[model samples]
Target: MVYVEVFGEDRVEKIKICGDFFLYPEDRVEYLERALIGLPFTISEEDLCAKVEEVLGDCVLIGATKSDLARVIKKAMVRA
Candidate 1:
């Protein structure tokens, strides 16, 4: 379970859960990413947390920060 960047290299990038996260159908990740795009980064941590929990309540969250995602990505990248 990890959070991944839903946005691209463009500005206003955001984070989202990376795993299956109880999302049905195979395209849910792509859908989630699209849902998060264009959202401002000005959102507070508490607000973001609440939003994430609501959107990904079924997800087994790895942690509550980008650093956690980075760590997981790093490990995956290394393993690959």
Candidate 2:
């Protein structure tokens, strides 16, 4: 799951990613979370997924796909 706090229309104040998912280069998970900080709330799922992919370059993620990450992120943005 993903949790995010948005302070303005297009800014993400903070975020957290946690679940049973596995991301190679395990330490990169924190990097990904940090990358999600300040993400635009208005970003589209596709774009968000692309961003995630960019942040996770060369890493392999199992038990989830970019789409899943996008969905959880989008949900966090909307419900934050």
Candidate 3:
């Protein structure tokens, strides 16, 4: 599961990501979170996925994919 909170109207003023997912080179998760901080709340899943992949680079994700993370972020936006 993942939790995301996004703020602001046009751009994401802040974002918080939390989840029960496995990521290789766990330290890179911070990079992922930071990468998402200023994105537009209207960002598409595919675009977000691409950004996540860019941030993850060569890291192997054990139990999640960039798509999965993007989906969760979209869901959170709906809830927000």
Tell me the whole-model lDDT of each prediction, alpha carbons only: 0.46, 0.78, 0.77
> Candidate 1's residue-wise lDDT over 1-80, tens digit each?
55454443432355454653344443544554555565554444455455544554465533344334334433432332
lDDT of 3 at 80: 60
Per-residue accuracy of model 3 over 2-78 as CA lDDT, tens digit each: 76777767676667777787788888888877777767777888888898889988988766677888888777765
Ranking by lDDT: 2, 3, 1
Better of 1 and 2 by lDDT: 2
lDDT of 3 at 4: 78
- The number of clashing residue pairs in each candidate reads 0, 0, 0
Off by over 4 Å in 1: 1-28, 62-80
Model 1 clash tally, residue pairs: 0
Tens digits of per-residue lDDT for model 2 on 1-80?
43444344667776777788888988987887788878778888889989888988888888887678778888878887
Q: List the residue pairs that clash in candidate 2.
A: none
Error of 1 at 21 (Å): 10
Worst 10 residues of 3 by lDDT: 6-15
Cα shift from native, residue 6, model 2 (Å):
6.7
Candidate 1, residue 74: how far the Cα is off, in Å: 18
| C-alpha-based local distance difference test score of model 3 | 0.77
